[model samples]
Structures are given as C-alpha cells and as structure tokens.
Target: MKPETPFYITTPIYYPNAEPHLGHAYTTVFADILARYHRLIGDDTFYLTGTDEHGLKLQRAAEAKGVTPKEFVDSMVAIYRNFWGLLNISYNRFVRTTDEDHIKVVKYAAEVMYRKGLIYKGNYSGWYCVDCEKFYSASEYLMIDGRPHCPIHRKPLEWTEESTYYFRLSEFREYLLNLLKNKDIVYPKHFRQEVINKIVGQELLDISIARPKERVWWGIELPFDKNYTVYVWFDALLNYLTGINYLSDKERFRRYWSSTHHVIGKDILWFHTAVWFAMLKALDIDPPKKVLVHSFIINKGLKMGKSSGNAVRIEDLLGRYLSSDGVRYLIARIFNLGKDVEVSTSLLDSIYNSELADNLGNLIRRVGVLIKKKLKGTLSSESIDNTLTDKADTAVHKFNKLLGEEYEISTALQEVMGLLKEANAYINSVRPWELSDPSKELYTLMEVVKVAINLLYPVIPESVSKVAESFSIQLGNPLDISVDVGKEYVVKEAPILFKKVR
Candidate 1:
C-alpha cells in the first residue's frame, strides 16, 4: 500500500517565563485543530509544541523566585505541560530549547554560519525590551513621554551596548524578498505582502544572535566562544529542527521537514520569515513548506498577553465552558488569520450557547431521544431525503474547501453549523417526533447529524466522540461522507454533549 502523505506542523515554542494564558491557548489550540484535521484525513501528521526556557527575562524571573534558572523553568514547564494536557493538545513532541539535542542544533547551526563567514563578532547598541527579548530600531519603538517604549508591552525600553555575534541577515534581503513573493509560502496573502513591505521599507540589518554570558547566563553557550550564549530567539527557533530529529534521524527529518508548516502569531513574523529564511539558507537547508501566521486575540483593547496584563486565564475559560472541547469550539468558531479577535465572556458564552448547546447539542439530543423513544432505539434502512442530503453534501464540500484549501477555519465551522441549522429546520418541517412511522425521516436526519458531527470532530473531539458512540455512528472520512440510508443506527442513549452555560 502507498504510504500516508506526510504532514508536519509546529507551534512556536512558548516562552515559559509566565503561566499559560488565553493567548497561549489560542495559538496552541489552533495548531492542534489543524493537526487533528490532517490526522482525520489519514495523513501521517506530527505536531510539535513546547517551552522556550532560556533568556534574560527567565534568568531574572528565576532570581526573583530564589531558585536556579533550571529549577524555575522546570516548575514553569510543568505548568505549561499540565495546561496543554488539560486542553487536550495532541502534540507528537514537546521540545524544549534547553534540551541537549536542541542546544546542540543551535550550536551546530551557529558554527556552520560562522565558518561560512555569515556570523561575525560585532559591537551592538540598541533600544531593547527585556520582555520581548528583542532590539527595536527608532521607527519600531513607540515614543511615550519622549522616551522609547515597547510597542506591545507599553513599557520603557532599555538602552544596552554589548559585544555579540551577528548573523548576516542583510545579505539575504534579496533572497527573502524573492521568497516572500512566491505567495504560497505564507498564508493570508496579505501577510506575505506585509513581510515584503517590511523588507522593502527598511534595510534588513544584521541581527545579533548571541549575548554575553556575563549579563545573561541561562542560554546555550556558543560552541566556539564560551563567553557568549546563543540569543534566546535564535536558540528557541532551532527547537523546530530538534523536534524533527534533524541531527539524530536523517531519513525521518527529511520526510517531515519536506512538508513542515510553522504555525505562528503575527508578532513574530519578522523573525520567522526574514531571519529564519536567511538562517536556513546559510545552513544550506530549504525554507519550510509554509509559514502560517495568525492575528492575536485582543482583550481590553490590547493584544492578550501576560506581560500586557490583559491576558485571560485558561482556567477561567474552562470553568465557564466546563470542558476542554467547549473552549476549543469557541476558539475555533472565532479564529481569524487576518484580523485580531477581541474576546469577551459574553461573546464566548453567546457562541457556546447558540452554536454548541442550542444548535449541535439540541440536534443530538432530539435525534437520539426520538430514535430511542419513538423508533424503539432501532433505525432500519430507508430512502434518504434529498433536501437534507444536499445540505450535508454542500456543507461537507464547503467545509473541505474553506478549511483544506483556504485555511479559513472559522468559515469552515460556519458551514458545519449551517448544516446543523438545516437539520434542525428539517426536523421541524418533517415533525419526526410527531409521526407514527418517522423511521425514514429520522434516518435521514441522523445521516446529516453524522456528517456535521464528523466535520466538528477536530474542534470538539471528545464531545463529537460521545455523540457518535451514543448513536452508534461511524465517524468516517469527512471528505467521503454521504447520506447512508441503508445502515442501521442503534441509539443506546441520548448524551448531553455540551451543557448550556448559565
């Protein structure tokens, strides 16, 4: 048999300086959904996500807690892992920047670039944000009270001068420009233009890739120079290679790396695109197959972040929704790749209530109960209704097109929800509950429900699985789903998939 097509996806290794929050959950859940979708379609998928443990910010945070850097990160990493587990993130590998293999990868890459004359020692002076772990040019920083401040954090920027090793990012400006123009490498075509515009507007300068050990000592030390450590961003980015077994397993690495998709937030666009592309070129490696960028989840008129002090806690959402699937569905429902999503409890509650509880949950309850109560829990084969079948088929088609082709996850979900709405309407029109022999109508409705639930499985796996099991429905490949009127459906029980949030 031919092998399943390889599909590799990754989330940015999060910085574990703070606990996991809504922002973290947003990105990770989105990646998880895509990963789950690929797996559902019979793809050999690998999802990678984890923590970035080395930086000056982490060093000071550890000091403030009176613990060693490793000790603090150990605890924080545990929290991140626990939170991911709570959210049902099905990551194939959880890579840490401090892992020995990752550290080695960073050092190896740096050494290759150094030998190729792409990295050189240089003195650097710039406005920097400790929170961001990045330097900002004059045009990049915001001026508040006549002083430079971090655009994201809204905090004062620090002026620092140090000797560091620099990567020749400027040399690859033409290469990156040509790359961004390909239009297929970055999703949401506008983001590709955004990167191209940035490269065209500003001269791509050589980026500092190392920090002096005297100031920040928690990172991977350079192989050639023990006095300097690899910059946090540089070190963190290599976790992608480490996660794919870049150095340890060549055949496996080649198979997965050929199909890599890096799912990242818009804030890191520059590094992931311009700098990352250059680094890969310097290492004689090809760029990733695609770089998927997403806008942020906003709260209180600011991008939700721990440092911004506007981050919503993940626990709070779980408490409100009462299940990981609820939170996942809400996020998938509101997810946007092009624009920022402003989140509020009211908005979330409305979506959960209207979509999950009222629409999907209601359909499942009605169908299962009707089958058990009226049909004696047994549904025999009968001719399927063409109207409901057409709606289900269109929904399946649009869903696959929007999600698989356009990567419009929210739009894809809307298509599925529309199917549910149609099924609910069909129920009202046919009045299955009132009919003495509504076996055909019920079977038709069940087929539509089967399609809708299968489409929703990626976003709400647990809830969908429960509904499928209760109705004895076979969750098959979404692309090939059709109205199976000949199959027998034995309803064991009507499961309450999602409880309405009061």
Candidate 2:
C-alpha cells in the first residue's frame, strides 16, 4: 500500500558542545522507532536529526580548545554522524546550522519577521544563562545560595546589558496559549499544560534574537543588520526548514512540513511549543503538527550531564551490548514517555539478559531447534489453534493502536512480551518435540514466533532480521498478523538471537 500522508519527524538538533551521551541517544532512538513504525505502516516518512553548531557554548568551547568555531563544529559534526551511523539511525537528512542553505533561510526568516514589525532593536538587561543561551526575566530567575541562578542550568547567572534585536514573543502569548490548549500541538496533556501555565499564567518576554558581532562572531549575520549575528536558537530552528530546502524547494517543503512532528527533551519544550511556534506564526507558516517531549535520562537520580559528572557515553554503553540492535532495544524499553529514567550498567545488563536473551531470544532458539530436529528442517501447513490466532490478532491490534496512535512504546513492548509468554506456554503445553505427530503443533508454534519477530523488528531491526532469515521468512508489515510460514518451507540452521550474558 502506498503512503497516504507524509510523516516528517525531527529530533532536536543536539548542541555538540560535548560528545553524544545516553540522553542524546534516547531522543534519537525514540524518533527512529517512530519513523520506522510509520514506514512499516506505509507512511512516507522523513526523519531529520543533526547538530546545533553555532552558540555561545560552541564558541566558548572552540576558543578553549584553541580551534576556530568552524573547525570545532566540523569535527564535532563528524563525531555525531559516526555515532548515529553506529546506532543505525535512518534519518533522511542530517542538518548543520552552518550549512550555506541554512544560513540563507535563517536570514530570510529574520528579514521577513523584521519587515512585519515583529522584531526591533532593544537593550536587554537581565540575568543571562550562558548554559541555556537565553536571558531570564527577573521573576523567572531563581535564587540559589543567595545569588540569582538559572533554574534549569543551576548555574549562576551573568548580569549582562547588551543591545540586540528582540523577537516579539509577548505578542503571541495568547496565540500560543490557545494553540497549546485547543490544538493537538503537543502530546501527553501534562506537558501541554506546562506550556499553558507558562504562557497564560505569566508574561511572555520579547526574546533577544541577535548577538553583536563583537560578542559572538560564529552565527548567521542578520540580513538587515551587518553588525549582529542571529541567535543560536533562531539559527538552529531554521534547520527544520533548510533540512528540506524550504526556500528553494517549495514542493519538498510542503510535502514534509505539512505534517511535522518534533521530538525534543522536556528541558526545551518551551522553545518548541512557544518560541518556535510563535516564529512560525509570525512568518505566516503553519505550526508543527505535534510535539513529543521526553524526559531526561538520569544517573544516580541526577540528570546526566558533563557538569553533573554522571554522563554515560553511548560508545561505552554500546560496548557491553552484543549489537546496536540490543542497545536500541534496551534504551527504548528503559525510557518511559514524559518521565525520567535512571541509567546504569547493571540496569541495562539485567534487562538485556532477562528480556532479550532469556525470554524473546530463547523462544526463537527453541522454535528453530524444534523445526530442524522434528520436522527435518521443513515446515508443513497446519491448522492454527483459535486460542493462538486470537492471541496474535489481539497483540497486533494493541501494538498498532498503542505504538501507532498513542505512542506508548513501553506498553507496546509489554504486549509483545505477553505474546512471547504465551508462545512459551504453548510450546511447553504441546511438548511438540515429544509428540509422535507434532506437525500441527510445530506449525502453530512457528506462526506465533513469526508474528513476535515482526513486532520486535521496529525496536531491534537487525537482530529480528536474523530471526526472520533463519526461518526463510521475509518480515513484512508489522500490522500484518497473518501467519505466513507457507505450506512447505525449509528452515535454516540458526544461532541464538541474543547471547546470554552474566
């Protein structure tokens, strides 16, 4: 079936001031899973992920490393690409803010906003959170250790006075509040409420959108002003447009941007739902179709970060897992939508050993072995028990409804695990290996196992491929619960899908 409507998804362009961590991997993995699910269901899907290379953070880090900002970003971009490649992220485009086309579109957006009287020159005097790269109003600043600090960054704020251009965010407060409350603009009602309280419950400030060249020399120069550069957030957000070449390719942009979904961490939820949405409205473009905000990955009960000294690198964690598929599976299983998940070596180890190796993988190994020994590596047609058929149908329906519409992955995996348990129980009850005439029981077992592998493919594509190949089966639409081992097929000798680890 051809895709009916395009599903364009984006993971927040990670700020590459540091290496990619488990927190970063969580967002990208979630986006990849959603993209893959959409693709399997026959949606024309496009996934965009990349680096935000221009910011005070990038500039400061570059200067500290004694390299130009451009050179630093170039090297960091390579690291990001390598990491995503290792994890098998199937994004259609990896955008960089420094790209020529991105700069062009950012300038275009700024010019259009400026002409509409939505941007103006102003002097900003407030607590500047260098870590967040945004200014906090007096009321928004938190007092810590008797000094004003940024609530999000937990760092002392710098009192700065600078003349910069500000975007009229206050003008869109009502529009943003209505958008959040009335539309399916953000997912998981609680997160939407968080935005509503911020916009409607309080004042929305006019955000500064430019930094003087003398202060920050590593961003897109404003089209109307030569002495200033676009703020990093402003420049970074344009990638969603430039990633699809919005300015030059109207058709491509329309096809993808018509229904855009953003996957971002909760820390930046306000930026997407408020600042970015307001910018789009100011530019006369439609707001994104939906926003999925995820909670941070924590370590030792603290959010993982370099400053926290608890950051877990993706590469280090990948080493313990047998394959990238295993790593992705555990992360998707570990993270719950809209809530924090603590990361640890032992946690992943246990989940992988019990779920993948012991439960799912063990079932696959048992099925392959039974078919090879009892049926002489050949499968014959048999009547599937109604009990097994109903189970398969229910699993497929729930998996589709949960993962597809509700975005409840953890629950979907629970459904898959339930089916796996049923398969195990069915195998135990029939004792196919011991029965003198075991064709029907073995055939039914294979069908159950086939459907389980199809459902697991979105989370662990590569590993599931091995399972499918071993049984001479082509993995198709996960929603297709039909048992398709065919009338008589030869099964290949198979290795354990996941090796048991201590």
Candidate 3:
C-alpha cells in the first residue's frame, strides 16, 4: 500500500574499520524499530544506514593489513551488511561514503560553500585522534598520564599542523541558539540544553573541513583544490544528504528531507546539530526535522567501543539468544535515549526469560492450547470482557504517546508488557480451562493478546509474526486495534516463540 505521509530516518553511517559489535547494533536496531513503527502506521518511510569508509583510521588499518583502503572496506562492508541482515535491519538504503555519488555530492556541496564565501583556505593545528577523525581542544581532551588523550579512545592524541580549508561554522552561533531554543529539533529536551550550554560557554570556531592529501589521501578531494581532500567527518556528514539524493532527485529529496530525523549517539551531538545545521543553512536548505540523540550502552563501567575492547560481539549475542528477534527484544527493552545503559549477560537473560519466554510466550502457549482443545480451533465473534478491553485500550494509548511523542521506546515496550501481564493474570483468574464453554473468556484473552502483539511487532517482528499466524490475527496498524471482538479466529498449532535460556 502506498503511504500518504513521508517519514525518513537515518543511523549514523558507521565506521566499518572493524567488525560490528553491540554498540553498532544498538543504534541500528533502534533506528530499525522506529522505521518499523512509522511503517506500521502507514507512513512512507525511508531508512538509511551505511559504512563511513573514508577516514585516517581506515587508511591506517588497511595499511597494517597490507591492503588498499578500498580493498579493506570492501571486505568490511560485507560483514556489516551480514550483521545487519542477521538483526533484520530493514533499511531502504545502505549508503557507502566511498560510493561515487556520495563523493560527487560532497564535492558539489564544498564547491558551492566556497563560492558563497562560507568556506576558505586556512591553516590549522590541533591535537587530533585518528580513530575519532576530529580535533580536540584543551578542555575537550583528557589529561592522562601527563599527556592529552582522546576521551573516547583514551589513547594518546597526535599534534598535527596543516594548511586546510575551514567551514564558517562560527557565523551561525546566534542562528543555532535561536533554532535550538525556538524549534523542537533535538530530542529528550535536556540534550538541547546541553548544546545550548556549550554554545553559551564556549565559542563556535570555524571548523577545519579539509585535510592535506599528504596526510590523508583516502577521502573525497576538494573540487577547487587538488592538494586537499575533504575532511572525513565533513565527507561523512554529507552521506545523509546523498542517501536522500539531495542533488540528483530534488523532488524526492524535498519530500523526505522535510521530515528527516537523524538518529545519533550523544558523542556526536555537536557535529550533527552545531555543524550540520549550519551546513544546511549555507546550502539554503532547512535543517532536519529532528536530531534524535541517544546515550551509549555502557559495559564494564565504560562506554562500549571496539577501541575500548570491552565491546560485546554480535555473534555472542546471537549465539545466546538463538534468534534475531530475541536480540532485538532485549535491545528494545533496554533502549534509552537520555542515560547510559549498563548492560550485562544476566540482564539480557532475565528480560528474555521473564518477559519473552515466561510472560508473553507462556500466555500464547496456554491460550492456543485451550482454544484448540475446547473450540476445535475455531472461534466466532463474541462480546469481549470490558475490564480486559479497558486495559488494552489504555496500553495502546500510552504506548503511542511514549513512542510517537516522547521517543521513549523502553517505556513503550513496558506498556505493552504491562498489558500482557494483566492478560496473564486475567487468564489465571478466569480459568478458561475449567469451563466447558470458555469461548467468551478465551475470546477476551485473545483480544488482549492481539493488542499486545501488535504493539510488540515493531520490536520482535519474527516472534510477533509467528504468534499472529497461529492466532489468526491480521497484524495491521496498531491504532486500528480495539476490543470489539467482531471477527472469527482459527487457532492452529501452538508455537513456542522463545524458549527459556537455561
């Protein structure tokens, strides 16, 4: 079905310098869930996720492996795609920064900025991290063992000086302040204040947007200058626009760009907001509709990163959970946009065994067995219990509010799980097993299950699809769900969606 309203969301094109980890899965899965939700509501949705291939880190990593940068990323991109496929990421486009179209778009934008005096040649010297591909000032870098270190990697920073080009990021200080204050561009409200505080306390200096080819040759070169390549960060940021065909397909770009939501981690908040918005302003384009920032998933008392070596492998998660849906459910349950989530295997096991296997899975199994044994696998329309109906209605309302308005995915899952719990208790109390004609009770329970499953479909799609098929439920728009109980249902064999781990 063709959707009427356009909705677009993007995950930060990940740096594919190494194998993907839980940190990468966390962000991509969250974006996938959001994209699924929008599609569920009949919105035209486009999801973009890809690899950030051009950078000093990739170049160095490739050199260590005795392969060209292109050869290395070519192999790494396959791994990323396979991992995303395993997790069931439903992205419409997986854009690579090394793609010819992306490179052209970067050069085109750079040329335009230079022509309009928004970009100029300049000399820059600062402490830089090859891993992060950005400069850190005195206040931003951490003092570690009497040396300045990259806060994220906790590695020693290199002091480098070069003649480069700078983007006039400083010129839009007042504009950014007003935009942040007046518009609902950033999510969780507090993140907005954090950016505002930074702007108020410090200066927005013109950012260096080019690197000398002698230092970093694996990047998009400047259109006007052959001696320099566009900074990796600057080139990377343009993938968002390139993914949407900003230069090639203007009409399509306008449609999706108007409702664009860039999903990112808090570490890059300044770049996405302070730098990105100004770049758009220079291009005479409107800022993205929302920059949804999420806090990191912490493991072992530190942010999970490949460099940190505390990162959880995606294979380990899949091996433990036994399915993509299981991993997806765990991520959705712990998803947080405001605060860092400290994660462990025990936490993942508890949520899976208690919620998916015990509560939701147990209810489906019991209900399916009783309905098949008693009603011979067919049920006619009947009046649903008002108490259960009211609970389902309330859960749906709160789920929509939390997910659609507040972007609180964890709370939204809780609301649906709460409804499932209520249904489980309702079944135990009603005891449909004892009664000979338990159609009414069973019907009520199934209605409640339908509501819960629809709400959860965005998170655990595979499990939800299985339950939907067994229970004869049409997984339609969640908003269309009500407890009217007007249709007939055919119960097939009961399926165990999630088996308890140990």
Candidate 4:
C-alpha cells in the first residue's frame, strides 16, 4: 500500500446568526494550533473555517432585524471573520456556503442522492429551534422553566409546518454501522466511541434534507427540483469537501481528504461524523478520516447562549487579555478533550498569571536577563559550552516525540513547560548571577537557556521572536520550526524577553 500522505483539519463551519462567542472561538483556535503544528512539521495541510449562512435561523434573524436574509447573513459572516482575526486564527480557507463553488457541490450531492431515489418529497411539521436550525423529536423537547425548550439552545421551540424533501437516512443504517466498525473513521478512540454509543446505537431516522423555498430561501437550490432548497446541514457540511472542490479536483482532494480531521463541538457531532459519513458512502466518496469531538465551553458552570444573555463574546477576551497565547494555552491545557469545560474571567486571569506569566514568561526573563548580565548586553558565540548539549538534545527529543509524533498536544505542552522548568532549575543551581570570572560552566548555562527558547517557540510564538532577539538569533520562519539543539547557535545577549503586566 502507498504511504498515507499528509494531514488536513477543519473547524465546523459556524452558524452566522449570532455574534461570535468564546464557545465558537475556542474550537477554531484549537483547530488553528493543530493546523499550524502540522504545517510547521511539513504536512501538506489544509485548514478551513468559515460561516454557515443558511436555514431558518438566518430567515428569522433577518425578520427580527428588518432586513433581507442575505443582508443578515452577510453581516454575521463578517463578525465571524473579524472575531477570528482578533484571535490570530490562521485559517487556510475561510469557506462560505454562499460561495459559488460550495453551492454547486451541495447541488451535485443532492442530485446524486435524488438519482438514487434516496431523496423524497415529504411533509415536515415539527418543533423547530431557529437558534439550532434543527427540528427536535418529541422526546428531545424540554419543559425547563415551564416551557418546551430546545435542549441544545435552551430556547422555546417553535411549531411550524411545510412541504420539504427528506434524505432516506434510514436507508443508510447498515452503511453507517459498517462504516463505524472501521476504526479509522474518527480519532482519539474516545470520540469514536461516543459516535457509536450515541449515533449508531440509536435507530437512524430519515432526515429532512431540503427546506421549502417559500419558508427559507437562503440555501442552495436542489438540482432535481427548483421549488426547494437543500437543508442547511446538507449545504453547509459540503463546504468541507467543496472548499477543495472534492469532486472537481480529484487529485487534490485525494491528497488531503482522507487525512482530514474535523474538530467540532459536541452539539454537531452527529452531523459531522455520522451523517457526513453516510453521505460520503452514498456518493462513493471517502468520509473524513477523523472527527475530534469537543464539549461546550460553559461560563461559571452555566451554559452560555444568546437567550441566556451571558454569552462571552470573543472580543471581550481579546480586548482585555493582550495575552493571546495565554488564552489559547489556557483553553488547550485546561479543557478536558471530550468533556464540557467552564470559562470565566477569573479562570482566564489565573491561567495567564500562573501558566504563561509565572511559568513560561518568568523562565524567559530569567535566562535572557542572566545572559545579558554575563555577556554584557551582547550575546557571545562562545558563551555556550558544548558539554550541556546532551541534556538539551534529550529534552527536545522527548517533547517532539510526544507533540509531533504522538498528537498529544496537552501532554506535549505540559512537557514543553517541563523543559522551561528544568531550565529555571538549571539557572538556580548554577547561580550564574554569582559568577564573577564567568567560567566554562557559565557558558553551559547559556546553552541550556538557548535550547529552552527554541523548543518553546511552537507554542508561544511571539515570545520566541523576542527571545531570539536577546540571543542575537534570527529565526527564519516559525513554520520552518526547529527543535534540534545541536543544529546551530547564534549567541548575542539582549534584554529580558517579558515584562510582567501589573
């Protein structure tokens, strides 16, 4: 068999009905970090994130704002782009369902199923949540706060009726079961198990796949019939493939599609891992290779949503915390991969001060400060002793093996911080501050400090550049990342790298 090629990953296309929130921001940033890492490590990686701009949600949001659905969705998509930009989310492609290529792919997908008799004209009358853009089963409606609420969005469910087209999802029960049996379908093992227990273990129901154009005209029109538009999920999910022109760009798609990983909040896991797999199998296409399911971000132990009026806006975090890496690090380190994690201002402050400032930042300041002290503010090439090279090599090897090879990001970050801790301990033990003649061992201390900055660059990118300035080293590209301690050395000492915020 040919060697499996490179890695690709994506955040779920977000609904553009509301302002961006931390719940949404957290997902994209985590995906961005993984994408950045894969690209840095030389994978032919593709990272896509964008807005899903169709469905009842868009229609209703437009009505509330006294505008056309197009205007409403356009404004919402802009918020998503700006908010993500603030977070430094490096998305390779910001695909929109409204994009012509995406529209064509969704139509093509619908046509294929229509030809197979897998789509049928049907009546859909049920409790719909405009916020979720989904119809809830009778069992799913909640009576919390003395009202029938959407379990996912916690808003009152609306009653509606209309003629629609439905995908013969029941027809794919066996196909989904067989696909789930294939272990490579979704990754990290635990996430796959959740899909099995929840999606496959439950009876598959035929899904409503198109909306009557009269009711909601914001989506791609079904090619088989012009009276209806494809369901928002049907149209939006295809952006993953259509973003790369999966059908049109055969060779290109073949390279990245199978290695693709979709990082989504648990709310949409069914659509991504299950329904997406069924659709691909029906079209004789490969399903996304992995789905990394994440739980929600709660605030003060309560779920945050629009109606709750407590949604933590993305701008709030970015504005208050100039600590961009600090927020990213806190989310990645504290979140339990497959379980809900809470967020609060206090929690954010704690992680910023405790992890980034006290730990990583303090380490950088100490080493760079000491280097400037001994070398008289100009780094010396001979300030590094060759004897300490082995220890540096061993530490970097252990971290790279865990982070790059094993996909253990949380463990990897912990290990990266461990390297910083070791360096701080080295400085304390060597007491370079006490060195008057500054012997060969002082150079050994410089070598150790230099190695710590190189290894920590991938996680805290900005700080690395500053640390490089102090060492008189010019890092070519952060993406051209290097963890090799013995590779090359540039020793020119400058000032301390971090200034702690009061």
Clashes of each: 0, 0, 0, 2
TM-score of each: 0.94, 0.93, 0.94, 0.86
Clashing pairs in 3: none
- What is residue 98's positional error in candidate 2, in angstroms? 0.5
Which residue ranges in model 1 land beyond 4 Å of their true spot?
127-160, 301-308
lDDT of 2 by residue, 113-171 (tens): 99999999999787888767667877898998898999888899999898999999999
Q: Return the TM-score for candidate 1, rounded to 2 decimals.
A: 0.94
- For candidate 2, the TM-score is 0.93
Candidate 1 displacement at residue 385 in angstroms: 0.9
User: Which has the higher lDDT value, candidate number 1 or candidate number 2?
Assistant: 1
Q: Specify the highest-lDDT model's number.
A: 3
| Preferred candidate (TM-score higher): 2 or 4 | 2
lDDT of each: 0.89, 0.85, 0.90, 0.71
Poorly placed runs, candidate 3 (over 4 Å): 1-3, 127-160, 301-308
Taking the tens digit of each residue's C-alpha lDDT, what string does model 3 give over 1-502? 5647999999999998789988889999999999999999888999999989987889989999999999999999999999999999999999999998998899999999999999999889889987776689999999999999999999999997768999999999999999999999999789999999999899889988988898788888899999998888899999999998988999999999999999999999999998999999999999999999999887774332233378888888888889999999988888899999999778888999999999999999999999999999997656778898899999988998899878899999988888889889999999988998988888988889888999999899999999999989988897777776768999997899999996
What are the clashing pairs of model 1? none
Q: What tens digits encode model 4's per-residue C-alpha lDDT throughout 1-502? A: 5554478888888888778777887788778877876766567788898888888878887988999988888888888888777677888899988888888788888888889988888888888887676678778899887768899788898887778888887887776767777766565567777777876567877888887777677777889888888878888888888877677888888788868888887778778877888888778887777787777767764332232467776655555556566556666676556567777666667667766777777765665566556666443444444435566666667767765655556676776667666666766777778877553454555555565666555555666677776566654433333333333334454444333443
Ranking by lDDT: 3, 1, 2, 4
Q: Which segments of model 2 are wrong by more than 4 Å?
A: 1-3, 127-160, 301-308, 484-486
User: How are the candidates ranked when ordered by TM-score, highest leading?
Assistant: 1, 3, 2, 4
Residue pairs of candidate 4 with colliding backbone atoms: 379-492, 379-493
